[model samples]
Target: MTYNKRICVFLWLVKGGISVVLEMLGHVKLALKCVTERERIERK
Candidate 1:
């Protein structure tokens, strides 16, 4: 029973880490898009 619980906890941690990484990537992509749009407007 303890071993199963440990595995479950480990899986949860890994899932959380993956989600955090994905969120960070999404934020970075959004920031990049905003910067690009600003630059394009300035070029005009």
Candidate 2:
């Protein structure tokens, strides 16, 4: 029983961690896009 519980928790944490990482990556992409746009405007 304990082994099953531990595996369940491990899977849950892995799933949650991947989601969080993906979210952060999305935010980073947005930020990079904004910065590039701003720089382009400044150049003009």
Q: Which clashing pairs does model 1 show?
A: none
Q: After superposition, how far is residue 39 of candidate 2 from its true place, in Å?
A: 0.4
lDDT of each: 1.00, 1.00
lDDT measured at residue 27 in model 2 versus the true structure, 0 to 100: 100
Worst 10 residues of 2 by lDDT: 1-10
**Top-TM-score structure, candidate number:** 2
In the order shown, the candidates' Cα RMSDs to the true structure are 0.7, 0.6
lDDT of 1: 1.00
- Sequence-dependent TM-score of model 1: 0.90
Scored by Cα lDDT, where does model 2 land?
1.00
Which stretch of 10 consecutive residues in model 1 shows the poorest summed lDDT?
Answer: 1-10
Write candidate 2's Cα lDDT for 1-44 as tens digits.
99999999999999999999999999999999999999999999
Give the deviation of candidate 1 from the true structure as CA RMSD.
0.7
